[model samples]
Target: MLAPVLRKIIQNKTVMIERYLPSKGNLFVQKGDILEPFQKLGDCMHSPNTVYFPKEFEPVKFLREKVYFQKGSLIGKIGAKKVTADENGYMSFDEVSGEYFYEDMPVKFTLLSGLWGEVSDVIPESSVLIKTVVAEVDLVACTPNFSFGELVVFPNPTEILEKFYLESFVKSTEGKIVYVGHYADLDTIKKARDLKISAIVAGSADPVGFSFAKSANIGLGVVSGFGKLETPDFVYKLFNSVAYRHVFFHGDLGVLRIPMSGVEEETVSSKKKKTPLKVIKKVTKGQKVQVLQKPHFGKIGTIDRVSVSSIFVRFDNELGPVEIDLPNFFIIE
Candidate 1:
């Protein structure tokens, strides 16, 4: 009985943390060092520098020739226009496609510890594994990527992330993981990226905008299912409770992790004391659930009865109980 309940606990005792070195170099900390979210972990030298210019240029020679260009020197010609080197850099050409790209001089790169954890193991100069306690919120949908930053909250989830709201918080959003309210569209997402926001959390988003987040490589996590849904009150409260804390958004794993702080320990303890309820559990009377259908999509309600193939739900929106089929409701686990 407890095994099924334990499965509902999305967060566990330990997290596997990975930090990448741009190139192999010195590992700053050895195994067993306690790490903070922003501590320097390692450093590397001679990281690749890639420059992509407009597609109008036509190269005179292929990159297989391994040519070098001086600063402010002409490298290619686009009809009457000459393409000159912006800086002293090596040039490599893709002979197969007849395309060339300029590579700037490599520079030193520093790697930072992304979360509060203990170094469980070290892979020499390459990477390290860290283990720590965390609280995770499962995202309904998300883009695949990893990001970490201080969590910033917006006051209202009903208001769409419009231009003015973002403009008001431009300074606060820079390099931070911002929680944009319900239903962010493409324009808002583009504006946030322009501001260099590290990541975005929202209740729901349009499919086109969500796809753009994926293509742009912006970290995004959707709390509720997509399309115009206001974030549920419970989820909003959870975010507010952890505002200003550092969070890790692991989109590929569908979890937004809030590493346990002293204040968070009490909250975690209280949750553990409560009986765990799972979304995949067999429907039982009086179980609270979120409805996922027309006229009640994203609304929370209570289970009234369970049949062979359908369960009756008493929604906050409806006057009487309504019948819904299996998999159409998610328990508020």
Candidate 2:
């Protein structure tokens, strides 16, 4: 019998799916079997399929490698991190002995079912200790869905190479990306970031250029515009520029349950011409309008009722919700 459950659970692992239908309550067991429900059925054989062994889930890691920014060595020591839980059900960390925590401690909702048992009592920060544990867990819940799986596609070598430039080879040993992008000031970066320009190919970046990137949540690529630029010099400069990595770590960790509102399509009226539900309008606003890019990618919140140009946008991209300067942006089509 065909079963989607078996196929979805064991994405990579081989499995034999058996089915017996007729007013049964979802789960069924073999007549002569004595093993538990989640236990493997057999030697992966087919037939009456006395049991079912769902496929095993293999994880995919997604990371952008070959950073352009540079000079990212740690001057101080990273003390032992105290992993603990907070009231908001989040994994957090504080320095134990030293005074600083390692900047890149891998945050976000990653599946660890096969690795850890049912996560229960969480210390203040997730890196700390697990206080409680549920005896046994349903493997189904532990299995990551296609959505979460897409979050981290394993980094391919080619993917790594594309992130770096010609004159610059990137290294990420001490939890930081070092690079040398060519730019003048914060406004220059703002202009470049708006254009989605990866590198600023020019002169020495203004001293405050790094600060601008940090504030705007943008990464400065070490461009070749600066005369006689090399990897080491770039890395050192970008390193002292920003004290911490630009990774955003927020919210709960155990079973990251966000509203999985999938991809949505909408249209806006060129003028007052209404069609379906176009959540918000932007790129250009009238005297009264607000537009925003949001924590939810592709999702836009509109303030049409109160004013115009007041909208928020969210994309699945790492940039989170971008506060598009509505007056400065425009609709292409």
Question: What stretches of model 1 exceed 4 Å from their correct place?
Answer: 1-9, 46-49, 52-99, 104-108, 157-161, 169-176, 196-198, 244-246, 269-277, 280-288, 293-296, 301-329
**Quality of model 1 by C-alpha lDDT:** 0.75
lDDT of 2: 0.25
Taking the tens digit of each residue's C-alpha lDDT, what string does model 1 give over 33-52? 99887899888786266665
TM-score of candidate 2 versus the correct structure, residues matched by position: 0.17
Writing each residue's lDDT as its tens digit, candidate 2 over 1-333 gives 110111100011111112222121222223333332223222211112111111221112212231111124322211433222121111112234322222222223221211111222222212211111111101111112111111111111132332333213222212222222322345545554554433322223444665566555544433221222212222233233322222111111112111110111012122322223233332322222212122222221322222254333333333543454434322211
TM-scores of all candidate predictions against the true structure: 0.72, 0.17
Q: Rate the local accuracy (lDDT) of all candidates.
A: 0.75, 0.25
Model 2 residue runs over 4 Å out of place are 1-108, 111-125, 128-188, 191-204, 214-333
